[model samples]
Target: MEQNWDDLRLFLAVAREESLSGAGKLLRLDPATLGRRMARLEKSLQTVLFVKSPQGYALTEAGSDLMQRAERAEQAMRAATAGVPVQSDQLTGQIRVGAPDGAANYLLPQVCAAIAAENPGLDVQIVALPRVFNLSRREADMAIGVSAPTAGRLVVQKVTDYHLHLAAAESYLAQHPEVSAVTDLQGHRMVGYIPDMIFDRELDYLADLGVGRVALASNSVSVQVRMIQQGGGIGVAHDFSLAATPGVRRILTDAVSLKRAFYLIRHADDRRNARLAAFAEALAVGLRAETARLEAATAGQAAPKA
Candidate 1:
């Protein structure tokens, strides 16, 4: 027999609430309207689904049995709807990803290229935000964030540790001769990420260095890197950002080593979605490879000069 899903939803709400008024409030319908809909549903089914009493409404035997079946039907319907679009081993849907500006600049391009190469049908959209995106509301299919999310419903994987160091433009270093001590930072015009936008430890580090005032401040890591390249000022950046940039040079100091982990996060519910899974896997692999390359580059720079 054909059944209306809306009626089933109303029935489930009434059954769970055990009161017509309560269910109406839950569904945002007037009590009279809810009563009329329930009556019509009972007439269509030709059964007394609820017993009205002074206390409230209670589900009858038929209604209880129907409630159980309806709940299962709803679960099955949701699963079926989600599963239909995804074919096994065939990735083909758009995956929206949220990432920080630095990661987007230094890492995401290669990952997107790899995903596109592996699954031509998959579409990837990257949104670079300085703050975290809400995954519970499906703001993004996946997120690469600096902090490990404490939300229980999210599946988080620690992708890799990003190494940060101080960098200065070659021209700036040429102008101000390298002093072999950390205290020498006092004389340099320092550029930095905006205080509120920077991660906590990095901000604290800057504070501790007595460089309380910024020569230049920016929210975007790419912008910060560019400003440093143009000899705007000295700033902290991930090793990868300065690797290929011609005018930037790393400032080697023992106090400058900072590392933060990158986390791959997605809702637990969407973890099984084929497109999201494929993209996440490809992204993780690509990021790890990039991290290794950056490490090797850093090591080479640290090597003794012949």
Candidate 2:
């Protein structure tokens, strides 16, 4: 049987993502279509490519062997296209950005909107996930991460630093006993990230702030913010996000605060794409302006208590 390069490409996407939905997300194909393509590819090759379980797609021995060949082909294709001239002034196609919920909710929309306004032909997809993006797997075109990638064929640049603090709704504070010190935190209900589901160490805000557990928990920072807004419990919030939400007031502001940085990450092979370069520059500019406001909020200037 003749080899199908397109089938191999689909195989590679599934291999990289380890799940049909994940690969479909990258390829912009339906999960069922990806599954059928994989099935056809397996039939043509006369070997089992994957072992599907609830956990996700896992490669078989045959699939693992094919992966090496596929990766080599991918590299060659990238090299062949590297020299092709791209229009620097016109941006088109999709750029997917993966980021943690805090930055995704508070920062990326405005930046992406401004970029889209300038290039009507461009589309931006923001995956506001609470996990680190794996650049080696082509999980996203660009990613905003809490920490820079230390090892990979990647380029990392510091976007900005922002602050976080323990906060509660003013109504909740008024009704509950005063939280005058760190020890008082233990006596109150807390809203926080699910302890075991936290993908990054930086998100373990409760432990860092001396609280051992939360009364309410979720995997999303946006959910935590909403929980705090509803007077569910005291929780950690980014100064930037909390600044815009009314009725939330910082607690133990002088005693408990955290500073974290964001990084712009891109695969080294994509470093020279003009559209990517332009978008990255715009992202940096937007982050700078937003972080300035975030800094001011930390200084007790942005959102005043009602």
Best by lDDT: 2
Over 4 Å off in model 2, which ranges?
A: 1-5, 19-22, 30-62, 297-306
Residue range 77-119, candidate 1, lDDT tens digits: 5566665664456567677889988888888887787778877
Q: Write the per-residue lDDT of candidate 2 for residues 176-255, one digit (tens) a residue.
A: 99998999988899999999999878778888878887899999998999999999989998888876778887888889
lDDT of 2 at 171: 79
TM-score of each: 0.70, 0.85
Cα lDDT listed for each candidate = 0.78, 0.86
